[model samples]
Target: MKLNTDASVGEEGWIDLGVVACDSAGRVAFSAARRVRAFWPPEVAECKAIHMAVRLAKAQGLANVIIESDSQVVTTRLTTAALYFSDLDTILGDILEICNGFNPISFTHVKRDGNTAAHNLARAVPFGVEQCWENHVPRDVAPYVLMDTLSLD
Candidate 1:
C-alpha cells in the first residue's frame, strides 16, 4: 500500500495539525485531514490526529495499521496511556472510542524532520478552520511533503 500523508500548522499560534492516509494493497483507498482550532490544546490535537488515522484505517477496512507521528506526547499516550490527559480527557475519550472500531492499531514516533509533511500541513491550517481537506493545500508545503515521503523510506 502507498499511503501518503502530510500536515501543517499556521504561524498564528501554537496549533497541532496532521494528515493520514491508508492504501489498500497498492491503491490509495482512504485519506484523513485534520486541523485543530486555536481553542483545542496540543494534547487534544495530538489525540485527534491519531483518532483520525485510526478512523481512516477502519474506514479502509485495514486490520493492521502502522501510525506515525512527530509528537512524542501523542506516541506515548497511545502506546502506554501513561500521560496525564487532564486537559484533553474529552478528546482522549473520543480517540479511545474511535480506537475501539479498529482491529489493531500501532503508533510510532518520528523526528520532526521526518514528519515534515504533516507539520507543514498543520502550519497551513487557517485561523478559523477547524479540520478539513476539501481544498488544495498551498504549494509552498511541497518541500515538506517531499521530505515526509522520503523519510518514510
Candidate 2:
C-alpha cells in the first residue's frame, strides 16, 4: 500500500488537509480531505496530514504501508528513531505510536510535483467540512487521480 498526504494553510489560519491511499495496482483504497481549525506551520500541517492518513489506513485494516509526503523534514524525522526537539514533538510521538499498530511501515519524501492527487485534494477542500471516499475516488479529485495514474507509466 502507498499513502500520499498533503496540507494547505490558508491566510486565515485554517488548514486544508488531504490524504490518499492506493493499493499495489495504484487503485485508491481510501481518500479523505478536511478543513481543520488548528492552524499550524506548514510542516506541522504536513505532519498532521500524515497522522490522519495513518489512522485511515489502520481503520481500513491495512497491515503495512509506505507513507509519502512532500515535506522532507517530516519524512526525515520519521526515518530515524531519534527524537528531536520541536513544537511538533507531540504529533511526532503520536505518529510513532500509530506506526506500532501496523506490522511495519516506511516513510519517504517526494517532490510536490509527484504528489498531485493529494495536493489537489488539499487545495479543493471545503472549509469546516470533511469528505471521505473508500474503494472509490471523489468526483472532484477524479481528474487529479487520473493524472496521477498516468504519471505512474
Candidate 3:
C-alpha cells in the first residue's frame, strides 16, 4: 500500500494536514486531512498523517501491512508511541485503536524526496483530488518509487 502526508498553510498561519492510503496496485483506498484552526505545528501535522494511515488500513481490513512516511516523528510514534499525546490524546487514541486490528503492520521512514507520489497527491487535494494515481507515476518519479524494490541478484 501507499501512504502519504502533507501540510498547507493559510495566511493566518494555520496549517492543514493530510494523509492518504492506496493499495498495492496504486488504487486510492482512503484519505483524511484537516485544517487546524490554530497555529502551525509540524508535530501535530505528522501525527495526523499517521493517524489517517492506520485508520485507513484498519478500515480496509488490511493485515501485515507496511506503512511509509517521510516524517520521523510520525514513524517513531507509530512504532514506539514515542510522543506524549496530551492535547492530541483523542486523536492518538483513535490511531492506537486502529493499530490494534493488525497483525504485522509496521511504519518505515522514507526520505521526503523519496515520497514524491504521496506528496504530489497531497498537493492535489486543494484541487479536490484527495487521492490520485495512474498505471505508473510520471517518468521523473518512477525511479524513486521503484528504488526500494529494485535489487541486483
Candidate 4:
C-alpha cells in the first residue's frame, strides 16, 4: 500500500492533516483526517501528518506501506540515513521506531498536484475533528481518487 499525506494550515493557526492509503490499483484502503491547532512550520506539520499516517496505517492492519508526502524535507530526512540537527530528529525517530514491525516501509516525496486526494482531505475536514474511512473516501475526495485510478489505466 502507498499512503499519501498532506497538510493545510488555516489562517487562524489550525493545521489540518490528511492521509489516504491506496493499493497499487488506486483503490482506497483507508483515509484519515484531523485538525489541530498548532503553529508549527510547514515541514513540521508535514512530518506530523506522516507520523499520523503511519500510526493509522498500523491501526488499520496495514503491514507494509510507502508514506508519500509533498514535503521534500521530511521525505528526504526519512529516506536518508544521515543524522541532521533540527526539530525533525525526534519526529523522525518516532516514525522509524514504528517501522520496525513492518516488513518493508519507505517514504517518498511527490508533487502537490499528484497528491490532490490527500490535499483535499486536509482542507475538507472541519477543525477539532478527526475522521477515518475504510474501503472508500468521502464525496469530496472520491473524485480525486477516481482521477488517480483513471491515470493508472
RMSD of candidates 1 onward, in order: 4.2, 1.3, 4.5, 1.2
Between the candidate structures 3 and 4, which one is better when assessed by lDDT? 4
Candidate 4 lDDT over 1-153, as tens digits, reads 999999987788999999999999988999999999989889889988999999988888888899889999889988884457778787888888887777789889999888999999887778678889988889988999888778778
- Candidate 2 lDDT over residue span 63-96, tens digit each: 9899989999899988885577878878988998
User: Which parts of model 4 have CA positions greater than 4 angstroms off?
Assistant: none
Return the TM-score for each candidate structure.
Answer: 0.66, 0.93, 0.66, 0.95
Pairs that collide, model 4: none
- The lDDT-based order of candidates, best leading, equals 4, 2, 3, 1
lDDT to native, each model: 0.56, 0.86, 0.59, 0.88
**lDDT of the structure predicted as candidate 3:** 0.59
Q: List, residue by residue over 12-113, the lDDT tens digit for candidate 1.
A: 544555563534332234434555445555555666666666665566566656677776776777677554548666665666676676557666787767
Query: For residues 18-101, could you state the per-residue lDDT of candidate 3 as single tens digits?
Result: 555555655455555455455636656666667766765676677766777787766776678654647555665667778887
Stretches > 4 Å off in candidate 2: none
By summed lDDT, which 10 consecutive residues of candidate 4 come out lowest? 81-90
Q: Whose TM-score is greatest here?
A: 4
Worst 10 residues of 1 by lDDT: 22-31
- On lDDT, the leading prediction is 4
Error of 3 at 121 (Å): 0.8
